[model samples]
Target: MIQKNKYLIGVIALLALALFTVPCLAMEGPDSIELDSLAELYEPVQFDHIMHVEAAGDDCSVCHHHTTGTPVQDENCIGCHANSGEADEVACSACHPANRFQADYLNKIDENYRLNHVDKVGLKAAYHIKCMGCHEENDAPTGCQDCHTRTEAGDKMFRSGKYAPKGGNKSRKSGH
Candidate 1:
């Protein structure tokens, strides 16, 4: 009887330790992440995830919405997701579609009448909205160049850098 009791206590202690330690280990995300989903135009953003985590005071919900099991902080979201627990996947792209406006994706959204997030933003817009909003509030760099450097394709599209039209604004007379 004494041996059985000791073994039971040992199992219970191990279970308790695992319950506390596993979540903490899972919460420690990568120190940095290369955000390259929109790399077609801009260079991949080297996001300092650890810094942002610290800045957010370890609250994953600041950027992760209600996916991290944290109570929703946004007044707009709290109504629907106050108790919506942790999601199976926490990646942004898992929920926000990369090609949000694609016909198939739009059709799916339209077909799913029960989907609560009918107006969900695309992946690119999600990053910009969340990052820019927080940066603005924290007085961090909010300029495009601060986070994204345009690629050659982007420069050409904007007609900037070397792609800019030559000649220093010399007015040309139109021949009638």
Candidate 2:
């Protein structure tokens, strides 16, 4: 009986450890998430999700922009954003009442974007703030050209090498 109990206890401990560690190690962010949320501003920033994950050393929540325990994977983003359970999974513009065709759309010449953008934090603001903020925080490039280089030559260069931070040859500090 004693030996059997010891084996059971050991198995339980291993199972518990595996349950916790697997999610941390296996939280696979998509390789390249297109941040077309703000395409009107720039030519839809194709964010290097994998690069960001490696740079932040596996802190997936930063770009995910969610709390560690937030109820997620229940549905895609549009479900909550459009405020409907039956809402169709579609382009953001499908439900959002914003005028994308306006000339000022790209420029964000509207004063709300210029002054109070952070308050409501629209799709454009969310992407920009998260991406640009992380870049600025990490001393990464904030220049639009640095990220949005999707030209013929640029695509070749981008795919050729894995992106590391300016001084981050090694991965960021690991936590588990």
Candidate 3:
């Protein structure tokens, strides 16, 4: 009976550890917070968190930008979005009304983007202006080969995934 009880306790502990670790290792499911862009649904591209964490030396602060000189809390992309220097920045919900368009977040543009003829911005331009701009300045890969493969000579990196869902779904309709 003593041996049986010890075995049962060990099994319970193993089960609990498995339940938690499986989700962290799995590429799919909400439990994993990989590739969390508002554009995710529009793209459905699963970011390899394990891969990035390994390559980037486990620095959670690498992707997070905060004015407080501290890392952002987990699962909070908007903290950085709201950190943009633009004076007239709007909420992600304003453009991504129905919570749809899944490249990860609503593809927000600066008001001056339209003034500069960037209103009908596509994924590539938006990503370049917003994400890649910083990555490039930091000596990161501004080219497709850095984050993705180039199937063609002129293929854009923003559209470099296995699939590129066209914009027009009701869930992803533009707020502007």
Candidate 4:
């Protein structure tokens, strides 16, 4: 039977890539930080998702990680959640580059972030406009909770750690 119809179409494409990358890693951003030990100056140290999705390979779209109406393009995490100016982009001056006055005062505190009126910008100015502008253009820790936190430092950065393939810590879940 054609090998059981190719094993039922490879178990229906691995159950439609786990219903599209398990809710895009169960959506995040409740001040997202599964364990950023503060030390990646330019390219190394965002680990702590149970050690980067299980030693960098459990596949959450394999770094191509994405969200917004999924398609599961090999597990796109959009190379670190795209849209900072697109193209190989990681935004926030793509590594803090408005000429570094402390990443230009945290990009002017992310263009004067607000809160209640909602023009708000707290994730430490969207994570210093994207992970301390690439760890301060490769220097790291722009201080201030090292990335913003309020309620008891977001409950001590969500109890510090322990996300593995068994749920991969989505922080709060918010994708479709």
Candidate 5:
């Protein structure tokens, strides 16, 4: 009887340890994440994930929605996902498609009647919306250059630097 009691206690102890440590393990993430998904015209953003995590007070729901097993805080999402639980993947790109305007992606969204994600923004828009909203609220920088440095390709596209309009916007005389 005593041997059985000892074995039960050991199992209970192990279960308790697992329960407490599981959440911590789930919250663990890389210190930094290189954001290069939309780095065509701009350099990749070296995102300091740890810093944002601290700024968010370690609340994963702030950015991850209800994917981190945290309660849904956004009123728009609370209706359908109040108790939806943790997701298999939490990365923004996992749900928000990069080629959201593509014909196939549009068709997929159109066919999925059960998913009420029709209004969901694309990956780039998602990043901008989430980041810019927070930055605005916290009085952080919202300028394009504040987060992303334009690449040489971007400069050329924008007609800036060496690509600036030659002759300083000279007016062309129309021959009548």
Candidate 6:
């Protein structure tokens, strides 16, 4: 009876984890997002999700690879993708600093921080490397306005695009 109870509990635990994590992972991230991280350098840029995925031949792994992470360490997609600056104890920038990697950036690390990428790069560097590198490889538009545009209309225009995820609805029944 005890063995049966343990097995049942284990099943329940697995079910709970699946239910919890699945919801978090459902979206293909936001579409037409105006970046707020480095608004000072240039006008806020809008990101088009559907266009990029289509350009990449429908392979989600190109960007979502952050979820699986590099060989050295495993990180949840939410950890780096969102990287909300509003909250205390943020994880992204301490390791991936906004400016270049230096002793100053390393000094900011929390005691429990885990170093994942073999090459140390900052949050700014990560965005530029991934987005620009892909564009350069594909010979796609790399113009300043081509990727992102100024959020001149104000916050109202940020998520105005509302790009739908695969399957057409939140159920994600259509499948990617």
* Candidate topping TM-score: 5
Clashes of 1: 0
Q: Which digits, one per residue and each the tens of the lDDT, describe model 4 over residues 54-125?
A: 433444433323433333453233454454222344222244333333566566657767622223343334
* Global fold similarity of model 3 (TM-score): 0.26
Which is the winner by lDDT between candidate 1 and candidate 3? 1
Q: RMSD in angstroms, candidate 2?
A: 14.2
Q: What lDDT does the true structure give each of the candidates?
A: 0.86, 0.53, 0.44, 0.44, 0.86, 0.55
State, as a TM-score between 0 and 1, how close model 5 is to the true structure: 0.79
Off by over 4 Å in 3: 1-120, 152-176
Write the number of the candidate with greater TM-score, choosing between 2 and 4: 2
Candidate 4 error regions (>4 Å): 1-10, 13-15, 18-46, 49-85, 91-95, 102-176
Candidate 2 ranges beyond 4 A from true positions: 1-21, 67-120, 149-176
Model 2 residue 112 CA deviation (Å) reads 20
Candidate 4 local Cα displacement, residue 105, angstroms: 9.6
List per-candidate RMSD values in Å: 8.2, 14.2, 14.7, 17.2, 8.3, 17.3
lDDT of 6 at 2: 100
- Over the stretch 1-176, how does candidate 3's per-residue lDDT look in tens digits? 99999999999999986676442322231322323354422433345556554444433334323322233343454544444432232222233234334443234434345532233344344444644765666686676456543444223444544445566445856789
What digit string (tens of lDDT, one per residue) describes model 2 on residues 1-176? 99999999999999986676454432433577676654543467776666666786564444442333222343444354333322232223343324444566545545556542223344555556767887898898898678775444444455433432356466767786
Instruction: Mark the regions of model 5 whose C-alpha exceeds 4 Å error after superposition.
Output: 1-26, 169-176
Q: For residues 74-100, what per-residue lDDT tens digits would candidate 1 score against the true structure? A: 898998899888888888889989999
Residue-pair clashes, model 2: 0
Q: List the residue pairs that clash in candidate 6.
A: 96-123
Q: Where is model 4 poorest over a 10-residue stretch in terms of lDDT?
A: 36-45
lDDT-sorted candidate list, best first: 5, 1, 6, 2, 4, 3
